[model samples]
Every structure is written in structure tokens, then in C-alpha cells.
Target: MALLNFSQPLISDETIAAMADTMRTGWIASGPRVLEFEQALSDTFGGRPTRTLTSATGAMEVALLACDIGLGDEVITSTQSFFSTMNMIVKVGARPVFVDCDLISRAIDLNQVEAAITSRTKAIVPTHFPGALGDMDALYALAQRHGLRVIEDAALVQGSEWKGRPIGSFGDIATFSFHPNKNMTTIEGGAVVVQDEATARRIEVLRFHGIERLEDGTRDVVVASGKYNMSDVSAAIGLAQLRQLPAFLAQRRQLADRYFEKFPQIEGALLPPRGVAGQSWNMFCVLLPFASLGMTRQAFRAALRERGIATGLSYEPSHLSTLGRSLGYREQQFPNAERIGEQTVTIPLHCGMTIEDVDRVCDAIGEVIGSKKH
Candidate 1:
């Protein structure tokens, strides 16, 4: 059997051409191209202000800083994350308090979040898990009622929508990633979109060493911002990807459909559920029936790799990690988060895959889950 890699980027001739254009301009870093890319994203996001960054982690840090959240302050985030969310909170001198995921939905439970909040709570980051909003309206409403900032870690949701609004459009502050593995790619990049102009300026300044310079060949215009500006090359690639995003999302949805249709019931393997909720389908993950499977999530992943397929877990639960421990988050602090982190398997889903590719991967999953049965 020919081995098909789990996931790959969808860069095309246009992406190369954009890179070539950036090379031809001789202004590779923070040039006109980045501005153009930002404008395109803003327009795509219903005119919301989106500032490109080196990575979503940086975006998250800057957004939190802009909101004036820091030491003695606490930010609420769920256990499902790439660790960067909690890390960012710590980076800004703030503490990260974790809550559990809704067992069936895998979204953060609103009640737990409400219970975690105290006077020191400054922000709430509701991560858009696997492309679904995770009850965004309620989270937003909660933040509004509490007067806390909301910076959504929507790294997995590029074209995902919430409550008829684009996920990036309505939050108090939002961040997203353009890593090669995400729904779209600028190779490795991110953006911070703010709800107000003043806050947006604060982010721009904080990202680029606080010394902002306009990319105009003019020598006198400086914006005194952080080193957060995107390179023209990266921006060009981002624009190219943006143009292909809608189509990419459609293809992902198609692949997910195949997974849903051909899914075989394995006692230990649980299919992701979709009710009125929709996923950005960023990653297709499933929980293993641990009791029957007799393998940890890591063991299961290694087992799949032996079959020449790639699989991974999106993250380790924040409250259970070393960094979390140093910050005083004990294992018992977030039992549900600890459990989800141990079991979730983030299988690959990217545009460079064919339906046959998806089936091959899906069959491999069934085979693994059925092995114990046999």
C-alpha cells in the first residue's frame, strides 16, 4: 500500500508567485504586501480590524497586554489548547485558571467558567475547538456581564462561523494562526483583530518592539510599535491562502462527510458528534474507548504511525502540565480537562488530501479500534 501522509499544505502556483513578487520588490519585511493582506482579511471578516503577527501566541500576548491584563490578574481558558494559551497568560504576568470541557460536546462548560471567575479575572479566552464556536454567544455574553475582556483563540477556525457572524468578527479581541497545519497558512503566522481602533493601535505597538515604522519608503513616519508586523513575503502567502480558504474549507467539509458516512462503530472509538453545531473541521479527533482499547492515546497514536499514517493530540491540558503546576494548578484542579487531554486524538485533515486519502486514514482508524475486538 502506498503511504499517504496524514496532512499537507495546499500551497499552489499563486503562493509561489506571491513569494516571487515579494522577492522582486526588495522590501521583504513589513511592506505594502502586508497592509494589503491585512485589508483583505479585514474585508473578509466583515471589516473587523485584523493585524498580522508572527504567530497566534504573540497575538494572544499582545491582546492581553492591550487589555491591561497582567500580574495578580487571572485569565480563564479551558484545558483544550496548544499550551500556548496558558503560556501566553503566564508570559504577560497573569495566571491561567482552567475549567473542564463539556464531556459530550468537548466545549468549555459555561458554569465552570463562571465559578472560576473572581475579582482578579481580567479576560476569558474561549478557544474555538475543532472549528466549532463552543457556545460563543454565551461566553461573549458572560464576558459582557462581567466586564471582562474576551480574546478568542480561534487558531483552528479560519472560515468557521458563529451565530451568523464570522468567528473573528465579534469578540472584544481575537487571535488566529496561519500555521501550515491550520485551515489556512502563511507558512507560520497569526493575527490580532481588535474591536476598537485604540486597542488595535496598542497591539500594533506591542508586537513590533514598540518602535513602529511605516513601510512607506518615506523616512519620517514611525508608528512606535512592536516587532509584530508581517513580512511582505508572509503577507503575500497569506493573501494567496485567503483566496483559497473558502474552497479549502469546502473540501475539508467534504472529507469530514466521508468520515461520517463510512464510520464503523467501534466500542472504544467515539465519533465526533454534530448537532446544530458545525465544525471548522480543523482536526478530526475521536476519543478512544480506553477500557476496551487497552492503550493510552499516545500509544494509539504510535500504533497509527506504525501504519505510515500521522496522528497527534492537539494539546496537553493546561492545568496538568509542568508550567501549570508551577503556577499552582494541581491535577485535581481540573479533572475533566486532565481526562480529555489524556484521551483526545487529533487526526490529520488538510486540503492536500483526496477522498481516497481520507478513507485510507479512516480505515486505518477502524482497523486499530477493531484490533482489540479481534
Candidate 2:
């Protein structure tokens, strides 16, 4: 049997044709295709000042620059998501303040966010873990109260929404990834969406190495700020991907429904997520009961591999890592994150999965953790 991939991008002939068009245009570096992609994103996601970049990491770096977040600033992010998030904070010369996640939804704990905010806190980088934004409204309110810039690291959130708002729709700034494993792929692209015009303009310039431009129907003015802009080829791919996104999300949600239903009776061993309809279902991650999975996360993953299934630990508690230690953060700094880090498992989930595929995975998981119950 062919191994089910953790995720896959839906790139049909349309995507291929788009790439061909970009190549034919011959201005494939950073041109109309990029603008087309960005406009498509803004229209689809409903955010102003949306600009595409090379990757989410690239977008994040530019967002920090726009915020003037550097040199001793504290940017709060969770430990349960991707490591690149915390690394991006550190890359901007700022200290990444770690926050534990709420045990229920596995998103960052709001109270911890409130506590982590000091005078140095410049931004709150909340993640919608698996596209479920737990207590996101509360998080936004907290950011507003503290006058902190909210930059949702929405890499895993495409269709995700909170209280009718897309995760990227209302943030001060939001960065999203377009890697192959993501709900969509730009052949590798991302973007920074900002609510404010000036910040948005800053990101636009920053993405292209600080070159400011004025389009008077012909002539363009250049400026002294910009770096890391998206290429026209990538933009072309993104345009095609955006058009296919609705169907892509629908398929992922369909599979998510199956997984939730298939494993509902498993009790505490397999807790499913509950949220509104727009969820991206980016990663079908789950937490096994401490009882059933007697072995640690690594051991369970090894067993899954032995059964020809692949698994992964999305991330670890950032506060307990070497960099966190160097920053003087101890394990106690974020106990919830530390625990979730040790237990979270990223199972195979993608738009390409079938009902039978879900069933097979569910069966394998049941076998591994059920009969081996501690």
C-alpha cells in the first residue's frame, strides 16, 4: 500500500498553465503576477494591505521590521506549534516570550499571554493550532487592551475563523505559509496582512528590499526600504492555488468530519476539536490518553513507523530548549506547553486523503494505542 502523506498540495493543470504564463511573460521576478496573487488573497481572505512574500518566515521577518520589533523586545508566542515561529521572533533580535497553551483546544493560553506581557512586549503571535482558534476573541481583546500589535502566525490556518472573522482578517499583522504541506501552496510563498495602511506599505516595501514605488500609469518611484519579496513565478502558482482553495478546504473538512466521527467513542484517548465551519483542518493532530499510550511520543512514533505509518512531533516547549535556557526561561516558565510538547502527535492529514485512508489511519492508531494500553 502507498503510504499516506502527512499533507499534499492540489496542483492541477491550471497551476501548470499559470506557471507557463508567468514564464512567457518574461517579467517573472516580482511583477503583475505577484500583485494578482496578493489581490486574490485580500479578496478571498478579506484583509487590507496584504502582500505576498517568499515564505511565511519571510513574511514574519518583514512584519517584525514593520513593527520596529527588535533589540530586547519581547514577542510572545506558543510552544505547541512550529519552531520557526519562535525562531522568527529571535531572528528579529527580539526575545521570544514563551506561553503555555490551554489544555482543551491546545492553542496558546490567554491568561499566560496576559501574564507574559510586560512593558517590553511589542507583539502577540497567537497560533490557531490545527485551525482551531481557542479563545481567540479573548486574545484579540487582550492585545488591544495592552496596545500590543497582534500578528497571528496563521501558517496552519487558511479557512479558520473565529466568531465569523477569518484568522487573518482582523489582525494588526498576520503571516501565513504556502508550503506544500499547507492547505495551499504557492510553489512556496507566503504573505503579511496588516490592518493599517502605513504598516502594510512598509511590508510591501520591505518585501522588495525597501524600494518604494509610485505608479502614475507609467512611471514608478523607487524608495529606500524593502527585502524578501515574492517572485512572479511563485505569484502565478499562488493565483492558481487561491482559485482552488475552496474545494481544497472542503475536502480537508470532509476528512476531518470522518476522523472526528470515527474516533468519537475513544473517550479521553482521542479528543476531537469543535469549531465553526471555516476551519482549514491543516493538521489532524491528536492527543492519546496517558493510559493507552504507555510509551513516550517518540516510542509511539517508532511503533507507527514499524507499522508503515509516519508521524511527527510538531514542536516542543520553546522555553525548555537551549535558546530558551540562554534567555533565562526555565521549564516552569510554561508548564502547559512543556506537557503538550511531550505528547502532541501530528498524524497524516491532507486534502488528498480518502474515507478509507482515514479509516486505515484510525485503525492503525487504535491498534497501536488500544491493545498496548498501559
Best by lDDT: 1
Superposed by TM-score, candidate 1 places the C-alpha of residue 135 at a distance from the truth, in angstroms, of: 2.1
Q: State model 1's lDDT.
A: 0.80
Candidate 1 lDDT, 1-374, residue by residue in tens: 55555566889999999899888988999979988999999987789888999899889888888888888998988877788988889888888888887654567878999999999998888787664557777887898899988888888887877767887877687799998888888888999888877777777778877754558753432433346667899999999999998899889888887887776676656656654444577778766667557766666777778888887775678777888777777876666566666677777678888888777777887887778566
Tens digit per residue, CA lDDT, model 2, 1-374: 66667667778899999899889987989888888888889986684768888889888888887888889899988876677788888987898887788764678888888988899999988777664677766877898899998888888887787778777777577889999989899878888888877887778777775765556554344534446778899898888888888888888888888888785345565454764555678877776655454566776777777777777666677777788788887766667666666667778788677888888887887787776655
What lDDT score belongs to each candidate, Candidate 1 first? Answer: 0.80, 0.78
Off by over 4 Å in 2: 212-226, 264-270, 290-292, 371-374
Q: Estimate the TM-score of every prediction.
A: 0.93, 0.91
How big is the RMSD of model 2? 3.0
Clashing pairs in 2: 205-226, 206-227, 207-227, 207-229, 209-226, 209-227, 210-225, 210-226, 212-223, 214-221
Candidate 2 to truth, TM: 0.91
